[model samples]
Target: MFSKSSNETKIAVLEERLTSYEIMIKKIDEAIQIMGKTSQTISKMLAVHEEKLDNTHKNDELIIDRIKTMESKNTEEHHRVIERFEFIDSKINDRIEILDKKVDEVTKFRWLILGGVMIISFIFSQSSMVVDILTPDTDNVRIEKPR
Candidate 1:
């Protein structure tokens, strides 16, 4: 009877240990499942980020191309404006030259007219003096009136 009782106690202790080990294995399985879910979530996030990066890169290229095109167009427009300004300046210079020539001609004509007037005045004044000297003195001379 003593040996039978000891064997029964040993069996009960082994059964308890087996139950604990089974519980521990169940917890370990749950932890593994959680880790797999976390890995999947991380992978999905990484894929999304990569896609966004690609789109951003494409957009940057497009923006750079547009800027280059605008710069070329601006350069062309600048050249056209410069050419137009130069043409206008040349035209103005030509007009100014023509005006200067006309002013010079007018000045010369004015001087010629003034010199002619002075010469004519001098001639008239000398002629009067000569006439007075050639005529006899009216104070000592007698004059007769004819009917």
Candidate 2:
């Protein structure tokens, strides 16, 4: 009977140790589940951040392209304006040359008419001087008779 009692006490001790091991296993399973949920949440957040960064990069590229296009257009317009100004300057110079030629022609015509008038007046004056020199005094004989 003493041997039987000792054997039963050993069996009870084994059963309590088994129950403690089961409780520890349950706690470990709960910890593993929490860790899995946290990993999934972190992965989702990272994906969203990556998508936003990609969109921002694309928008920056688009803006840069548009700015380059506008600059090219502005440069083209500036070239056109410069060309127009050069054309106008050339036209003004041509008009000035034409005006100078016209002025020279007018001066020549004036000198020619003035020279013709001076020559005609000189010829008329010479004729009158010759007539006065050739005319004789006809009243001398009548005066002697009266005396």
Candidate 3:
């Protein structure tokens, strides 16, 4: 009788342990399902981030190309402006040279006219003195005695 009761108690204890083990396995399965869902969510987020990064890279390349094009245009425009300034400077130099020549001609003409006037005045004065010395003046004659 004691041995039968002991075997029965051992069977009951094994059954309780089996039930607890089954509950633990169910909890572990639930945790694994939740982890699977979390991993899927993380994977989706990573995929979205990768697409955004690709788009940003493309936009950066376009921006760099636009900047390079603008710089090329600016360089060409700068060269054109410099060429225009040089042309204008050459024209100004040409005009200045012509004006200098005209000024020099005018100065020479003025000097020539002044010299001609001085020569005429000197000749007239000398001729008048010679005429006065040659002409006789009888209205105011006077005699002087020498001692």
Candidate 4:
């Protein structure tokens, strides 16, 4: 009977230990469930962040493309302005050349007129009849008493 009582006490202690192990297993299961929920939430947040990053990258690409387009337009406009300026400069130079030619022609005409005037004056001065007709004959004038 003493051996039987000792066996019963051992069984009771083992049963109590088994109950404690079951409780511990239940708490670990609850912890595992909480960790799973937290992991799911973190995954969702990461997905959202990745999506936002993708959108930002897309917007950046669009902005860069727009900037490149603007740069190209500016370059084209600059080239056009330069070409126009060069064209205007050539036109101005051509007009200046034409004016110079006109001035040379006018100067030659003036010189020709001056030469003609000088020749006419020399001819008139050397001619005796012209000189006599143009000037008064004071030396040849004789005063008569009977006039």
The TM-score leader among the candidates is 3
Q: Tell me the deviation in Å of residue 137 in model 2.
A: 23
Question: Candidate 4 residues 8-89, lDDT tens each?
Answer: 9999999999999999999999999999999999999999999999999999999999999999999999999999999999
Ranking by TM-score: 3, 1, 4, 2
lDDT tens per residue, model 3, 25-143: 99999999999999999999999999999999999999999999999999999999999999999999999999999999999999999999999877766797766866776597677
Ranking by lDDT: 4, 3, 1, 2
Per-candidate RMSD, Å: 6.0, 8.2, 5.2, 5.0
Model 2 regions more than 4 Å off? 1-20, 95-147
Q: Pick the winner on TM-score between candidates 2 and 4.
A: 4
C-alpha positional error of residue 113 in candidate 2 after TM-score superposition, expressed in Å: 13
User: Tens digit of lDDT per residue, candidate 2, span 35-59?
Assistant: 8888888889899999999999999
TM-score of 3: 0.72
Best by lDDT: 4
Enumerate residue pairs that collide in model 1: none
RMSD of candidate 4 to the truth, in angstroms, is 5.0
Candidate 4 runs further than 4 Å off: 103-147
In terms of lDDT, model 3 sits at 0.93
Across residues 53-104, which tens digit of lDDT does each residue of candidate 1 receive?
Answer: 9999999999999999999999999999999999999999999999999999
**What C-alpha lDDT, on a 0 to 100 scale, does residue 106 get in candidate 4?**
100
Better of 1 and 4 by TM-score: 1
TM for candidate 4 is: 0.63
